[model samples]
Target: MPTPDATRFTVLDLLDLNLNEQNALNLRCIGGRKGLSREITVPDLNRPGLALSGFYESFAWQRLQIFGRGENAYLKMLAESSNVEIYDKLFSYPIPCCIFTHNLAPSKEFFDAAERGDCPILQTDLSSSEFSSRVLRVLLDIFAPQTTIHGVLVEVYGIGILLTGDSGVGKSETALELIERGHRLVADDVVDIRCVNGSVLMGQGANKVIGHHMEIRGLGIINITHLFGVGAIRDKKQIQLVCGLEEWDANKVYDRIGTEEMTTEILGVHIPKLEIPVKPGRNIPIIIETAAMNERLKKMGYHSAKEFNQNVLRWLESENARALYFNRDDFL
Candidate 1:
């Protein structure tokens, strides 16, 4: 996993990001254009209602300030009263920026205070709650814990499977076969993974320059999209299962019954794992595909291994009962 950094992003970077329309915050600069370069270090947002009320004891001025309808109205009241003390106190801190929700216009005093403080003032058409939720979601994703792993990630049967092993373990080769079988390849060689919502593991390519490109020992670097079209490539995927390939060990006993489920933890999230032994003739790609399908079945509450064990027990019981009955009839 990549180490966390004290990354800082400017208000202009946030504005320039091309988020999907459904999750867009619709932010636009209304005033304090000179402060657009202010840094937004934290992902959390702050409501300045208390600050506007002159409660500066525990003000979170470092956060991106949010001014909803109530805060806007209070600012108007403060403007009418010619109360400049609260604004001065609030703007004294290095506030990153102020956002007005519901497309609310800022009062002249509020704009003047932002300009003087060099804090950017932004507006959004979304309601206060909607804007808050959208901005928070985006920020959480941006600030999520990230790491890079040497593996190949692919989507097989709608399940994201991460294949890992030592060098020349054929991780990319298996992924190529999976793609040939109509599955989608997420990343090759260097898989960039992030912890989303503290429970989900999201994987993508580490570098966009060589994204969807795989390096096979004999074939060199190949572009999956160009060879297999767009359907064979995916930008990102939620990693659900991890498959570890190892050189065949004759002395080691592999799980043949599949009765025991194994898991590997990444960033505090445990993901289902399968260790497949590699051999001269073993079909690694097919095994991975079956593993992915079985994982999906388990998610749907149908565990193949458990079901197989139950069926075996039921059959044994029936055979035992029949044998006992036949023996009793012979005795009679």
Candidate 2:
């Protein structure tokens, strides 16, 4: 599901985004202040090159119309014709905004048309290609499917392992130990998982304020950053493996051989899952670290369980062939 606030995204939010260097859009309002509240419903951009030539068929008016150098020149040519009717027709559609890259500015007549239609006109210092890539990235993340999961997300052996199970099942405790072992903690209690690019599950804290804090049974609440320093915390990580910490059940027939792989679905993506039973002296952190390494091995096409089973089958086949040869009438 798209984020609740994604539907309400406006041109104002794009201007107000807190982006860092390289990803910063450097966008500013150049005209049509009344249209700043216009909602951006799409994650794509339109060049408006063909639209400027009066070819309105299949015109993507819903997207952010980009006016690069070529489009700006065309608009200038249209302005010289003493015809403002084309600009009015362009603004008649409920376009989110018109963004001019390379810090390009439209003519006075263009701005007048935008003001009449209440369509915001934005400008950026970045080039057309750079601005298009940056804006599309930000919009994809905003429109990605997101859900809040009650679990602790941590990185073990450079692999993101999500600790999930019933409450008080030692999920947080296991993550705390993993953190003590020098692994990074992504999120403690509430993990906001977003499915990016339709396959990768990116996990981070739901709330930035309480992200690095963990709630222990006896210790109440503790700040992980202060306890372990900033090197032990991560802002976000891709969830590669899921380790379900459940109370050790004697009757449950757990897979001892590890031959049959198990997986669980989160946001339509199937992630490799391991149900690690929790009990005294189990050393859950070590098991998770090992599981992370094993997952890496599996990704490299080396499955330990399958390899061992193949070796055993080879030995059994050889022994059976020798016995049958020795039991033949001529050999006896």
Best by TM-score: 2
Q: What is the number of backbone collisions in each predicted candidate, taken in the order shown?
A: 1, 0
The lDDT of each candidate is: 0.88, 0.91
Model 1 alpha-carbon drift over 4 Å, by segment: 1-6, 30-41, 105-109, 328-332
Best by lDDT: 2
- Candidate 2, 131-214: lDDT as tens digits: 999999988988888888989999988899999999999988888988899999999888999999999999999877778999
Residue-level lDDT tens digits of model 1 in 130-204 = 988989888888788877899999999999999999999889899999999999999998998889999999999
For model 1, what is the error of residue 163's alpha carbon versus the real structure, in angstroms, after optimal superposition?
A: 0.7
TM-score of 2: 0.92
**TM-score of every prediction relative to native:** 0.88, 0.92
